[model samples]
Target: MEQQEVKTPEAVAMLDMLKAVPQQGKFMFGHHDDPVYGIGWDGDSARSDVKSVCGDYPAVMSFDLGRIEIYGDKNLDNVSTDRIRQEVVAQYERGGMVSFSWHADNPLTGKDSWDVSDSTVVKSILPGGANHDKFMGWLDKIADYLNSIQTADGTKVPVLFRPWHEHTGSWFWWGQNLCSTEDYKALWKMTYDRMQEKGATQLIYAYSPGTEPKDSTEYLERYPGDEIVDLIGVDAYQYDKDTFGQNLENALTIMTQVSKAHGKAMAVTETGYETIPDSVWWTGTLLPAIEKYPISYVLVWRNARERENHYYAPYPGQVSAADFVRFYEHPKTVFAEDMKQFEKKK
Candidate 1:
């Protein structure tokens, strides 16, 4: 396959690892904010809900850059950038992969990411728009952060950078209903170019839309281009057991087809049932839904420390803990300890 051309050796190797994962008949399991916090603890680097439930940490550790665009000391979740940097490096050192998602604040409305009050937000951040320069500054902050992720020897750690995600939904300012197709494409390209110009080379870009694309056509409706995206992913959550399995299967089929045609990797960028109400959700629902697909990884959302009913992955004594152990022990599921081979490539 003709892979996307990345600038750095680390990024090239990381992309290769993503490409080779499914060929080996395995898909990595991931968790958002796994090392930073968990269901009952905060700021503990040694703690991970997935690890507590199973025996190893997730293969992919996802972080957010929501407040990074504004030069905030902490992310929107109040996790400090210093902590994120530390944990990101720690995860990489542990032979695990790191992925970042950005929920950038609305530049036009000066509100949160969910502020889709203005329809011209995407247009205003393009090259010639009024907020163009300001947006460029925001990208600079992002670039700086990305560039700062380094090992003890100062070697940059390769990371999967996912920005402007879930654009298929109408919740964020950059959503489909708020921006034209051309403008959205331009936004992705501009971010890519800026990262390159600023020397943030150890990045593999992922383009992920919200779930339920009818087919490959709809999945790629707002695709920036194969040149800018190293991975094709989708964010699908389980609202109910009845429809989630078939829905996920259908989405993965579309993702597989699109990824093969475009020579990009594919993943379930975000997924999980809130609170894991079902005891066998891991193996019975999620595992079965994705087992047949050639996906690189499946990342569930965070296990929030504050909200009682807002967690995704299981904790130590959660109802799904036993079943999660089964999922972890499954040969098809890959975790941090199982990533040594891929880490060798880096």
Candidate 2:
């Protein structure tokens, strides 16, 4: 596929690196909030559950901008934006990539992202809506945060920006049932245009829907457009062990086809067996499911310190730790250290 044009040089390089991963027969290992906190600690600089199990950090580290829309100092998960900025730059310095997801509050109800009481929320935030200006203000905060992630030399760090994720599910206010397809597309374009106008150019936009889409036709139901999306991904988590692999493989097949048609990179944007009850889940389950796909990366959810059995990746002494080491050592898996090669070439 030909290279896709982007708004900034850094984003172009980042997209190139992402596109090269599958061609090189490797996919990056990623973990949400990897270095920011882990299964037993928070606010510890340079600590990660993945690194604790293996010896390297994830190549792609995911962060959430849940409360940034409200101008909150800390996100919904209680992570401070200041700390997130520091860790993002630190990861970039270490030759790793970062991605952000927003769980912005519902504009009409002033409730959390999960609030689906009002189905008109999407319409309320578009141009000329009562909450249009308020939502624009929220976008300003997000744009500022995106632009603030820079190296000491003032070069902006390129990042994967995924918003309105999992819209196929009705759990969030922007879900399929909550908004019209045209409204959803409009919402995405509005946000994209606003970010560009605000100069948050160091971004590669990713469109990630939940696993409800069984085929390309279903998947593209709410797709914004090819011109605006750099990556196409799916967020599917393991619920039943018996059906997870087949379901994930099916989703990946659809995504691979769609991405090929669109000339875009693809990924397993969010996935994992929570708490990792199976000892060899990494190699036995997750790896086998994704190994055949031309995915750029697969990111497990975060390891919440405050919640019991809420972690995804293994920490030290966990049942899956040894198998995770084997996963790390596998030639198909790329970590932060492995990413240095791409950085040098870029």
Candidate 3:
């Protein structure tokens, strides 16, 4: 493929960046508007909707890294890594500012049972530390992969690398189920240090703890540090419309509170609300909620459709990008102080 020279910008030092403001902004959380909105209509296909919804976003979500596996004896090599990396970068260049999220029970390196959320993998990595080496190694590999990319000005892609997101909840292997606060903190630090060692400075690491904390103070405790993160965000979903409404509100309040507290931009990294025959993401839920907030970006789960995938939006009868454009340009909705509005609202 083609390679470009990359020049790193003097981005506000992440910590100092957090200090610029009181750590709060408008429209911080997100939701899917018109399940068919930006995705248009195509049924439940995942890849097809990528192009359409890509236009609606200021940043694209890298679900592949978050959900897909590529390390260990999984036949990972330059060709293997390069293959997916090519596709990812192509998607990145196509979509522009891309943010990624992912989780794997397997430490950051191996391709073993740890990749699954099952008990075996979960039990192996829990608490005061059990196979810490493997976990650290896995992180090294992940960082190597991130450092491999270059931007148009010859810089690595500045990714919002969010791993083990929503740790406040108990669903994934790394959730509260497997580790204590101290262990979790170590895991976060190890990953950060390894990535830095690899020269993967393009990262704007995000620590998205869960929103189900006993209160706001508890939520703040989940933050690893402003030192390792550039933004603050959250993820929540409701099985039905009713529950979704309540949870969406809670999510917004928490995301806004977290971002403002940390002086960071915010978005909804993941959300899915199913409603009977149509799991309408746009009109049914996201639209009503976001109307009252000024979110930075709303990244639907990158997947298209899968029984196991709660992170996708349906393509058929999909909402058009026009809806997002109107929202983006809404006179009262401010995106960010320095956002680049490249595409006009459709």
Cα-lDDT of candidate 1: 0.90
Model 2 lDDT tens row, 39-58: 87988977888988899999
Any runs in candidate 2 off by more than 4 Å, and if so which?
A: 1-6, 344-346
The predictions' CA RMSDs to the true structure, in order, are 2.7, 2.7, 7.4
Clashes of 3: 33
Query: In candidate 3, which residue ranges exceed 4 Å CA deviation?
Result: 1-47, 50-58, 66-84, 91-95, 108-130, 274-281, 305-311, 316-346
List the lowest-lDDT window of 10 residues for candidate 1.
Answer: 1-10
Sorted on lDDT, best first, the list reads 2, 1, 3
Candidate 1 on 234-282: residue-level lDDT in tens?
8999888888888888889898889888999999999999999899999
CA displacement after TM-score superposition, residue 138 of candidate 3 (Å): 1.3
Which scores greater on lDDT, model 1 or model 2? 2
Which whole-number lDDT from 0 to 100 does residue 115 have in model 2? 95
Model 1, residue 199: distance off in Å is 0.7
Best by lDDT: 2
Query: TM-score for all predictions?
Result: 0.97, 0.97, 0.69
User: Order of all candidates by TM-score, from best down to worst?
Assistant: 2, 1, 3
Model 1's number of clashes is: 0
Backbone clash count for every predicted candidate, in the order shown: 0, 0, 33
